[model samples]
Target: MGRKKVLAVIHTVAYGKRLLEVLSLLEADFRLQVVFTAPPHAFGDDVPAFLARLGSVVLPWAQATRMTFDLALAAGPRGVQYIDAPLITLPHGANYLKRVTEGPNAGVAGLRRQDLLPGGRLPAAVVVPHHAELRELARDCPEALPLAHVTGDPVHDRITASLPLRAAYRRALGLDEGQKLVVAVSTWGADSSFGRFDALLPRLIGELPAPRYRTALLVHPNVWAGHGAYQVRSWLARCGQLGIGIMPPEADWRSVLIAADWIIGDHGSVSLYGTLTGAPMLLATSSEREINPSSPAAALAAHAPTLSPTHPLVDQLDYAAQEYRPEEYAAIGSRITSEPGRFNRNMRKLMYGLLGMGQPAHEPVTVPLPEPLPLNAWAPGHGEVSA
Candidate 1:
């Protein structure tokens, strides 16, 4: 038989980057194609580009509508499988029904309840990173099967590899040799809940004693694009006015992670990477409960200090993240760093399994898989599976 072809549909650069890393390890076993919803326009576009250059076909998101299920069905007959990486459901909340019914690309677009049906015709498998997400998907689309919960995030792996030389990294970034570095990776949200650094900026600046520690803020591309360069410039100006040495967002954040003495940010996989790198980290929670932490994110928070409005340090700095007791953080952190190869190995297993190559023999790590919830429990209207 010929090599099995696999197409990975990813919604963002981060997920695409992880897909690429997994594909890179399995290039010898299968033919791979990577489809992205947009170009790599984020802080970590390098990984995505590298993967595309390494023989993964890039399909424009706009052009995807023309192909439809017909294309996937044709490919399936030839031993090709379509895999949708973790995708956020569109039209979130009350607007969901109205938006799906009225959108230009409405009526059974992308991966939906109908696609997972026995003869409805979709890919052989769909890969979701977190069990909570998988449970939600299963509840909404019962026909879909639960694949392995492969926890390996390429971004986390990249960040982990850079932690050892953090001191040298600090010196290279021109921060004072003795001063500790605190890095904050901001996120973009519809409400000001996650991205509002305006209140926290001045307070964090005041908390750090000049020449004792310096803070570097790495804003997500979505936030920077939405707020513009002027917002960042203004923040930098304020830091300068307060005698704080602000490091401009010029370097790739993975390298910046290498230089960081401590990290603080809203819930995201980046924080998980920080934990894997063994960086002293903190999480800023969302007031609106918009940002939900993944398993790894929760695992990392279990090890690190979580800053919240109630903490004593909350008054010292105007940021928000639930504090993780010292013992919890240490326990979780130790487990993550103990087996560096667990993530890579498991990811390889999932990729190979999707291609029907059977599972490879590998030592298993004690990563717990959360219980899968029934589909009917979440969305009652989705019971009629697509035929």
Candidate 2:
């Protein structure tokens, strides 16, 4: 019998990297074709090359209208099953295309209600990142079937797998021994009207007592595009004048994060990455109105030292970090890390079922949470690690 074909549609490089990683792991079970919205550039350039290296056929769809419908039509006649990962929503131009061109057996992975119709029927199965994301999806869209919550994000799994090269990474970044590194990551929409980073950045940078650690300010591409690189460079110049060694915003942020002793940022997926690296995360938000607390990013901050510029929750931050042990971190990590394999297996089974083939003999993998780690040891000097 011929191998079943699957079309994995990834909207961005981050999500593309993730889907590609899982596809690589499941390569033997099915024929995979990757359709991306655009070819990666600048910081995201590594993703497509990485996917190509994994031996998948990569197709770039550039025009929004043609990209959505044409790609689906091209894949459909070839008997390819469709899967949407993370942020590939049904709204925008894709919605009409999805309805017109999608094969009968199309599915959505990591789907949430906000990404679909208000009363829409759930797809074949929903892929989630963790229990937290699953809970949020359930609360928001109860109709969706919980096909699986893969413990690990493919991107994170790739990141964690590279941990052994830390020393070499540190050397490449030009870091000296014993000089502590702190990474401050900027998020998209961080400069919106509700965001007070103009005031917050200066205060945060001023508060950092230097010579103890070197700070790297990693600006988001969106922010750079909005304000321009020259503006970011000028701001970093001001930060440097204040004694903070601002790492160029153009550097590969994942590598920078890997080399950091700590991370400070607004709530984002990067915090989850920080958790995997065993780095202390200091979350800096502008105000409660600026972010949704129920968000996956916020949920991550709830379990860590999240600080808001306008509303200081210092005492709560201190207590949470001190109280939660390292074993707890390990437990959380394990819970989130175990999901990828199960997701891959289920995806394979779903494709087979859609193809009218007998269900694959794939079993879902369950990963037990690890014991909490000692929080006190990593907590005390944590304040000095953030901007």
Candidate 3:
């Protein structure tokens, strides 16, 4: 019998990377076709060529393709209308932060209403990151519960697999022995944690004490959208001059996440994902100004230290480093990511069962990963590694 045809639609780099990671493992079961509903500029130049090497026939949403697909995968609501087949909504990020306090249908998830489904039934299943996600989906869209599956995220699987390489990652980033690293991640917008860093950076750089503490800035892709990549890189260059490292938008932020001693960021999923590493976390309380303070990010912050520009940044980091709690971090990480090692098997089950292809005995494949997309990294005169 011929392999099933599946259409995978992607927009953001996060979604593209996760879906591709899983699909790359299922190359033997499915004849894959890809469509990028997002603008070409939103992606790096390497994407198309990378997909081509995987034997994917990239299709433009407007272009007519006579081939029929048995199933379709989309990371967001925007990609839903662009594909034709039984749809599966596999989210790009775990929406745990905004939903807990604001309810399930807040932030990026509000658009993914059950009624939006074609014929209100095409999405045979909704692949979620964890049990918390399933609960949120049930509270927000109960009708879609039967279709939901807690399969976790492929990225989480990849992140878990990369845990043993911590030393190698730190080495690649050029960290000297005993040098403590702090990674501050921003999720975009003027209200994001990254925005608060402009004034805070000087104070942090002045107080953190050079030879002992090293810092890195990770900006979200939406920031690149608001202020083009070049402009964002230029703005980040100033931070680099102060002996801070800049994490390029196109490169995987996980590299920094695994190596950092403590993380300082906003309510973005990256903050939640950081908990998985069991690292000490300090969230920028400024994020609560725009987003709800009672949200999951705030809830997770209850477990970590909170940072505000008005507060003593250095003192807080020292305190958090000393009094970090592993149990609390593990509890939060469990809620955001489920079945870490078994994600691939769960994904295979969901896809095969939903597609009515019957369960096939499948094993994970080791594919050669490409180099990081060519993004301009900021390297000031200081001795800092370029991400």
Candidate 4:
């Protein structure tokens, strides 16, 4: 049989990152040729550079949709229905948490009824992380429910799989014995942690002594791509000077999450997914208007302690841990994904089935999360690595 071609529709840097995780299953198989494209998106800034860094050949959005392919995969919904191939669409974030602010799909997240059925068409499959999302799809886009599949979350599997290496991860991040790593994460937009608490990183740096607490800032890739890298760096210059390590947009954030002793974050996937790392979590921000009330992200906001920017940062951190309940957080983790450690296996089977080909003759591997990026090095010294 001829080698199959796959088109990966990367709508943004964030989606590209998630798509890369799913694509890892395809790496060992030499029978497929995969190309990429960055459809027009507000956060499509760093996509070409990101793909170029990987030495990936990309076809322009217009040109790519015109041609036929064996399969097409996308993490976000942006001009995907036009692609001429059997398409599989996955959520960029682990849960369909965010409530859409505008457009025809407003009030709901990006998964629009029209997106699921653009002019009486449906994607070959819609992969959701949890079965609960199937209900959401049924209510929002019932016609697309039959096409929905629950393959589980790659990020959920990776974070949970790396828990045993937590100590090693801490060491790689330069966290000495007795030092706690406080990772402050934020999703993009005005409702994110950074938006609600602008001084969160600096507060963590200033209030908590460097010897006892090491601080790191992990923002969504869309934040970096939305405002040019220069602007985002400029905004965080003071925090950087104070030694708050800003994680690179493309870095493996799972490493940071794994090593983290305390995660103070907003209503983002990384924050909610941080529960699996065995680290007690505290909410740095929340947006009732933005987060779906029934979604898992919202469920976390309901359970975890909310960090007060004005209050003593260390005291709140102490309180959160002291009041932590593993059972509650574990339940939240359960909601993130149904199939534990099976993302690679299930995705590979689905892809190969679409290709009408036999299996690779070996067990599909769930690749381990790598060490934290040197660019996001967290230590006592005051240094910065801006993306």
Of the candidates shown, which would achieve the greatest lDDT relative to the real structure? 4
lDDT of each candidate versus the true structure: 0.43, 0.44, 0.63, 0.81
- Model 2 backbone overlap count: 16
Worst 10 residues of 3 by lDDT: 378-387
> How large is the C-alpha RMSD of every model relative to the true structure?
12.4, 10.6, 5.0, 3.1
Query: How do the predictions measure up, each by TM-score?
Result: 0.56, 0.57, 0.81, 0.94
Which RMSD does model 3 reach against the true structure?
5.0
Which of the two, 2 or 3, has more TM-score?
3
lDDT of 4 by residue, 341-370 (tens): 888888888988888998888998766666
Instruction: Supply candidate 2's per-residue lDDT for 374.
Output: 17
* Model 1: per-residue Cα lDDT over 254-277, one tens digit each: 666656666776555345455544
Could you give candidate 3's per-residue lDDT for residues 204-276 as a string of tens digits? 6787887888888777756765566678768767666777877654456776787888898777878877887
